[model samples]
Target chain A: MVHADSSRFAAGMSTKEVYAQVLEQARTLFDGQRNWVCNFSNTAALLWHAYHSLPAPSNAVNWSGFYFTNPSNPRQLILGPFQGQVACQSIAYGRGVCGKAADTKVTQLVEDVEKFPGHIACDGASKSEIVVPIVKDGKVVAIIDIDCAELNGFTSEDQAALEELAQLLAESCDF
Target chain B: MVHADSSRFAAGMSTKEVYAQVLEQARTLFDGQRNWVCNFSNTAALLWHAYHSLPAPSNAVNWSGFYFTNPSNPRQLILGPFQGQVACQSIAYGRGVCGKAADTKVTQLVEDVEKFPGHIACDGASKSEIVVPIVKDGKVVAIIDIDCAELNGFTSEDQAALEELAQLLAESCDF
Candidate 1:
């Protein structure tokens, strides 16, 4: 009975059919939805309205978000569930590029952010970025941030479709 | 120099000139930015992209966000900065209608969340709601939840223009 009918995910599809219908509507709107803030607030509003009609430089996605690790600041990184603008709420673990992708767990393809050296502009028109980390079981439970205004806006098929939607949000939220 | 240029707060105004140019662009993008999570992440992306071109039973805004007070449960409320959909992360201090607008600090105009009795659906196509509260020195800092699919869809001129943008975000952020 998976039917929250988001108009059956419509809108001029094809960016690989909108990330394959946004990873099959984030596994039917998050299987078993164990409330990680309501499955990261409906998976950050289904990746900010499914990359707003993907065509040009990945449809110029201004920003899309998530950033976790607040078991009382596990080395820092708060601000979770987002859409866009006004950010930089925590990020300390290693410092920038979302604390070096949460201290190198992996996935940071930052195409520009003015040559990413401790880049934390937050949104001075975020020119390009991508950070994915959601490694449960062994740890690192969340991290998926995306920003773009243009310059080299993300792709290796948008980082293998956001690392398979961050491994189905680290096996269906509950972080 | 207030140049955070959110495309000069675009969109064809009117709704009292887009809430008086979104309270003068949230006081020039939050005057003297004291950083309450970057001024509620650019005042919830300037009221979810400035009410997306108003006029559809008041531009059917599905949601816009912010909900603070949870530094290890300071009476509860664990979700801040939002856009739409997944919600209800934490809410105690009086519960629902964003904890009675943070325990009656004020502003909870529900034109109809199927008759707000303890209404906490999160987002089943949110029928109508508005909850201002961002007190400051006198207390209760943070809470601006807006949602609408239609039904009465907010007015008292959007509760006195979001209670004057929640008294200018409780006198400009840094909560």
Candidate 2:
């Protein structure tokens, strides 16, 4: 069942209002369901829905989803449930944008995929991307990756808000 | 391992070239993978990445994904793997844009979401959307739904190309 309360956010809202609401929604949704899969699934959907509906730069969001550390292989990150196209099955540590984020436990804010050295062109159309690691007990358990059609699509606000959401997920959900 | 052949499509290319290449890539990627999840997953990712990277209009794509008929509940469309934000988990027959497309077995190219009556406000930022039903054996199997941040984001070419891709999926992948 989908959330019937679609009026939670308006289309004309600023990026800050939209993201703040998204984070709030994440907390509410995640609190009710502490499972990692359920939480990530709903959170991804929330992020996608909010960003696409928000005003520009945030409205330019094309891809909003997650990739988690492959339990079978600790050093690799496997595709978790996401909302976009067929992505790479697994990414090794320090390999691509996701890999670097996982390795360093730092968010990688890529302004342009074309300029990012050794960028993994999983989706050729993704011009810019941001990968935020969900750190649990000082270890990155998963990453939230968002792609946009426009270069420099993400701003400091996006980073701060997403990082806050990542912290919330790490604290609340068991991944 | 990810696809290392990033030189196949250049950023400066035309939308037609990018979309054509995306279709080709879909074919190659879906060759041995007939599972619906694999096909839809890759297809959504492919569309999201390609459309975002393409020149404006097409590059304005914010959400590119699918909705398939729920096996347990045939009259409804269950959310499938997608590339955008959180979407309606289940849509009844003849309801919103996706439901109408699935119900009528016709493509719905909505130039403006605001004008489309009964428009399900899943993503407020989506100004325009296109839904193409994937018919298999005279029955509606699935629908490819793409949303854009700008109004009138989809052109006739997008419709034709996506319909073709939908047909390919209908024939090649098993739900």
Candidate maximizing TM-score: 2
lDDT of 2 by residue, B25-136 (tens): 8787767656565567667777877887777777788778888786657798866667655656667989989999999999999999899879997777788999999999
Q: How high a TM-score does candidate 1 get?
A: 0.32
Alpha-carbon runs more than 4 Å astray in model 1: A1-64, A67-80, A83-127, A138-142, A148-174, B1-12, B16-43, B46-64, B68-75, B82-155, B160-175
Question: How far in Å is the alpha carbon of B34 misplaced in model 1?
Answer: 34
lDDT of 1 by residue, A1-175 (tens): 2233431347678777877877776776666445565566557667777787666677688778777776755777776667765465567877778778877878898889888887877667778889888888877767888888888888798899898888888888767
What CAPRI grade goes to candidate 1?
incorrect
Q: What is the Cα-based TM-score of model 2?
A: 0.60
Candidate 2 local Cα displacement, residue B107, angstroms: 0.6
Flag regions of model 2 displaced more than 4 Å: A1-42, A45-80, A83-86, A89-175, B4-9
At residue B26, give the lDDT of candidate 1.
75
**What is each candidate's DockQ, to 2 decimals?**
0.10, 0.17
lDDT of model 1 at position B156: 92
